[model samples]
Target: MRPSSDRQAPGGGPRDFAAAEWTKLRSLRSTWALLALGTVLTVLVSLLFCALIGPEFRRADSAQRRALDPVGLTFTGLQFGQVPLVILAVMAVGNEYGTGMIRTSLAAIPRRGALLTAKLAVLGATGAVWGLLTGAVALTAGSTVLGASVPLHTDAVRALAGAGAYTGLLAVLAAALTFMVRRSLTALGVLLPFLFVVSGALAATPQLRSLARLLPDRAGLRLTQVHQDAGDLSPAAGGGVLLLWAAVAATGSYVALRRQDC
Candidate 1:
């Protein structure tokens, strides 16, 4: 009996790169763990904070005790949850390069661009699902305790949708940057400090608030809050900035891949 062929011709039939990537994504434990961690952190931490605020916390306007934006406060942990998403995204793409599996992936496809796209699609879809599930659960649980202080309206819906989108985008952008950097620790070191440390510092400075509005996570944070600063960047602008970052990172990775002879 003839042995089965393991090779696919270049530029042949529908590629099915999506299927290939889906298998790879699902096979990884880090992906699922990070997602679960993000959800738990968002829902549990937010709930704990709400409970701590209790009935004693009243607003200056006599609106209601614990009159904070329930929706926003509920999704507050996403700010921290985003860190794991970044780590997961980085590991997702970086693992291939780190393990030299990227060469094998390119060998199977022979078209590096197609391989990258497949990876992007898989990561993006996974992120979207993770974001939606986490946001929904957290919102539902947190709002139950917040009561009438939280409004049920179109604005609230938009904020929930925005949170999901932001989480997903965070994953994609981080993955792209990982591909560009091609090193797990290097990407994490650079991105973490920039997003968490640098952005936090800048946010504290009055003069830099306008500039800080341009930060990636800051724009994403707007998705959870009903009220935004006058100087804050719009969600649309934030999406554009993220897209630009993704594009640059992806392009850089592609160029490096082609030139590095890997």
Candidate 2:
């Protein structure tokens, strides 16, 4: 019988590239730092919202209180914290381009598609873990301070799970955008404001609210709300829309990576 070593296999497939990408991400101090910052900011901002809102909520009329959603409040910190997460995801691709190390990376891997896929895999996993953690923290802290609680049997479970998916998908989209832009700052400049500021503003406007809700952040964040908003889609639908955006962005990025020179 032939030895295992004698058998030939693909040397630099997606799996191998993914492993290499994971190792590269793990080796970066900035990666760890940004992740930590995102997590910490999420928790702190959640706590702050609780501290401020809890008191006002306690004083509000029953009519006003009836409209408030505890789960929505829990996730308020994510709005701010997600900024850092996006930065981290974009930087995974952005750093290489900025430092002119993309040439070196491409020289070693040669397959741009595989490299891009590997980075997405690593970022997806990282974002999911942190998103879940941040969601749980926000939920607990907000409930404690606001004295607002939701039963486990309700949509609370879906909300929590959605939080994880939302973050992962958002990060994946950011990575794809970074690949297309080839500059961390440029990607950040576009993504952060749109997701954080512009999306929210548009969603708040009477004229554009309907169209704006279709944006990735607006659609994705809806899933994290324990109670449904008047105009919001179902959690499953919202998640699907977010998934669609990520898929499109990834496809576009793959095409750009394959066609463009490093």
Best candidate according to lDDT = 2
Put down candidate 1 lDDT per residue, 1-262, tens digits, no spaces: 6765767534443248878888887887877888888778777887886666545443334454324666677787787777777888888888888999988988887877777777776777777778777877777777776543454687668778778778777777787777777889989988899888989999999899877877778876776666544676665676667666666777786776666666
- Residue 162, candidate 1: C-alpha displacement in angstroms: 1.1
Off by over 4 Å in 1: 1-15, 52-68, 149-152
lDDT of each: 0.74, 0.84
Task: Name the lDDT value of residue 156 in candidate 1.
Answer: 69
TM-score per candidate: 0.86, 0.88
Which residue window of length 10 is worst by lDDT in model 2? 2-11
Clash pairs for candidate 2: none
Q: What are the RMSD figures for all models against the true structure?
A: 3.2, 3.4
114: Cα error in model 1, Å: 0.8
